[model samples]
Each structure stands twice: as C-alpha cells, then as structure tokens.
Target: MRKVSTWEVLFVPLFFLLILYPILAILGNITLEGMVRTFNDPIFWDAVKNTLVTAFFAALLSVLMALGFAYFYIFHPGTIIYRIADFMNDLPIALPHTVAGLALLLAFGRNMFGFAGPTGLAFTLLAVVLAMFFVSYPLAARTIASSAEEIDREMISVARTLGDSPPQAYRRVVIPLLGEAIFSGFVLGFSRSISEFAAVIMFGGNVPGMTQVLASYVFTKVEEGEVSMAVTASAFCILISLLLVLFLRLEGKLHARSEKSA
Candidate 1:
C-alpha cells in the first residue's frame, strides 16, 4: 500500500473527532430502558409516522419540481427566466431555517389561499410537508441539475432531429437517463426533510400526533428534561440517517457498475 500522507495522518483523526465522535457519543448515551420507553410510547410512533409520511411527500414534491428545473436548466440554459430561477433555487441552502419557516408562515398562513378554509395551511400536516419541502428543494434541484448537465447533449439533439418535440424528447430520453439522479435527489431531499426541526416547528407547530416529527419530538423531550428519551430519539434518527447513507453508497456502486458495463 502507498504511504499515507502527513496531512491525512494529522487530519483523519481530527475529522473523526469533529464528526464521528459526536454521533458515537449520542449512540453511547442510548440506554435499554430509554429504547424500550421510546418503542413503547405511542407518541413516538406517531412522530415516526408523521416524519416518514411528510418527508416522503416533501421529497416527492421536491423531485418533481426538480425535474422541471433540470429540464429548463439543461435545455434552456440561456433564458433570463432560467437564470432567475437558477439563482432562486439555491436560496434555501443559504437562508436560515428559522427565516425559511417564517417565510412559509407568512406565505401560507391565515387564508392566503381562499380555499384553505379560513385558517389556511399553517400548523397542519401540510405545513410540515411544505416546511420540509422548502428546506429540501435546493438539494433535490441541484442534484438533478448537476446530473442533467452530465448527460450527452447529442442524445437530445438526435431525438429532436428524429421529429420528437421537446416535451416528448424529454419524456422519452432525458427522464430515462435521469433515473438514478432522480432517485438520488429524492433520497437526499427525504433525508434533509426528516432532520428538519426549526422550520417544521415554527410553521407546523410541535403538536404531538399531528405535526410533530422525530426532530421536533427529540426537541420536545429535551425541553421536558427527558434526556434519556431525547438520546433514544437521537439514536433512532442517527440509525435512519445511517440507512440513508448506506442507500446512497449502494446506489453509487450500482451506478458505477452500470457505467462500466455501458
């Protein structure tokens, strides 16, 4: 094996100390009694269901919107509209979560839409989904757009030459080529959504069995001085995050294999 560089030797442990150590610490705090309590708690299960369902919807919406963004970004790159949208799409990543939550609250709360039945979407499950989507959209859009940029432009040109309209060409050619990217984008968005706390709490409220998700549930536990329950919930979140990381790694390997075969 090649000798490890001095920089790697110095920084590798530092990286683990900064990153992995905290995760390990959280896991270390997990106790059997806490785990049993968390598992037995109906509220915990409700939060789990809410988290998964809202995250799934948020991620699905993010990926769908990202597909449109990627299409415009790849096919109509020079348009002023695309330029404006491209800049705006990254706003979420830079904005503080609290600010994003406040923005969502302002935009959708209190009869902003006439059909929202007077109270509008704020503090509902839909608000949870919207908050998650707001924060996660940038990740999904950027991931899809980056992958779309890598596709051969010639394929699209050939499809157009064969008399396929832009929409049809995108449907038949671009989307098929974007399968892995789309999946990756959705997974990335879902992972981000599941971990969102500040935004969800601000817009959706921390109502147990309603808008409460795992992140907010953990926060609630911490606030109520249930450190053990908080640790258990944090460990559970870490486990879910680990599974998502494994999925991304597996997807990367599969994509690499497919590319090699191609």
Candidate 2:
C-alpha cells in the first residue's frame, strides 16, 4: 500500500468537515414525519414538477448550444468568432449568479422580444429556464469543448477524404464519438440548473406552483421559519442530485467497458 502523505492527512479531515459533514447533517436531520409531510404537500409536488421540467429544458438547451460551440471550437479554432465565443463562454462561470440574474431581468423583463406579452418573461417559468441556462451553460460548453479537443483530427480528415462534407463528417463521426461527453455535459448542466437559487429566485420569483423550484422552495421554507420542512426539502434535493451523480458514474463505467470490448 502507498504511504499517506502529510498533505493528504491534513486535507482529509478538512474535506470531511467542510463538505461531507454538511451533507451528513442534512441527511441526519431528515425525519420520517417531515418526509411524509413534505411528500404529501401539493406545493412540494408542484415545485418538484417545475424543477424537473425547467431543469430538463435548461440542460437540453445548454447541450444543444454547447454542441454548436464545441464543433466550431474544434474545427475552426483559428477564427476570431471562435475566439470571441470561447472568451464569452466562460463569462457565466465568472459572473456572480445574482448579477447574471439581474442582467437577464433587465434584458428580458420588459417586452424585449417585441411580440412578447406586456410582462415579457420575468417572474415566469421561462425566466427560471433562462436563469438556469445562463448559469449552467458554461459547464456544458466547457465539458463538450474539452472532450471535442481530445478527438483525433485524423478522423475528421479521413472522413473528409471519404467525400464527407464538414457538417456530414461532424454529424456522422464526431457526434457519435462524443456520446459519453454529451451525456456528461447534459448531466452537469442539469445538476447545476437544479441547484440554482439566487439566479432562479431573482429572475423567476418564488411564486409557488409557477416559478418555484426545489431550491427556492427550500428558501421559502427557511424564510417562513419552517426548519423541519426546509430540511426535508433539502434532503429531497440531495437525493435527486445523488441519483444523477450515480447515474453518471454508471454511464461512465459502461462507456469504458464498451470501449474496452471494442
């Protein structure tokens, strides 16, 4: 067995204290009564539905946009447009989420789209989706771009030599090879979207059965001094996040096995 280093010993306890302990505390606080009450609450169920629906759309949009960006970055790395996009893609990561939400609110709160209704999109479910997408897009874009960078250029060249056009080559060759990366990017975006609070609450508002999601629901409970309910809701969110992580891990192992078999 390898000997544990001093750094490992020093960091391990810190990791447990800072990260693992909080998760344990949340889970530990869950009571059967609270769980039942949370489960039976119609508002909780509505939040679950809203959260799942918005998160799905947000993640899907992020991945679709990321695919286009990744393709450009991989195939046209020398272009100024690619450079601009590359720089802008990381903006979401650097921006404070509340600031991002405020920006979205300013941009979309009014009738920015011209044809939109008087209220535009703010304080609506669509606003929640946009907020989630704004915060999560960077994760999807970076994940896909990094994976695309690892792809063999020779494969594209060979496909081109075989009379495949660039788009055709991308669709037939690159996309098929990026199955794992695409799934990972989607999951990462979904996970980020689901946990978003500041942005979602700012842009979407905390209106139950409409824009309220699990994160905002928990916040609402906390504001109401319903600690038991908040903890229960938090535990539910953790369970969902944990399931997504486990699903990703399982997918990764299966992808590895398939690669080995091939």
Query: What total of clashing residue pairs does each candidate reach?
Result: 0, 0
lDDT of 2 by residue, 118-182 (tens): 66789899999999999998899999989998999999999999999999999999999888899
lDDT of 2: 0.92
Candidate 1 matches the true fold with a TM-score of 0.95
Top candidate on lDDT is 1
- lDDT tens digits by residue: candidate 1, 1-262: 9999999998999999999999999989999999999889999999999999999999999999999998898778999989998999978889999999999888898847546856578889999999999999989999999989998999999999999998889999999999999999999999999999989998998999988999999999999999899999999999999999999999999999988999
| C-alpha RMSD between model 2 and the true structure | 1.7
Clashes counted in candidate 2 amount to 0
Pairs of colliding residues, candidate 1? none
RMSD of each: 1.8, 1.7
Clash-forming residue pairs, model 2: none
Quote the RMSD, in angstroms, for model 1.
Answer: 1.8
TM-score for each candidate, following the candidate numbering: 0.95, 0.95
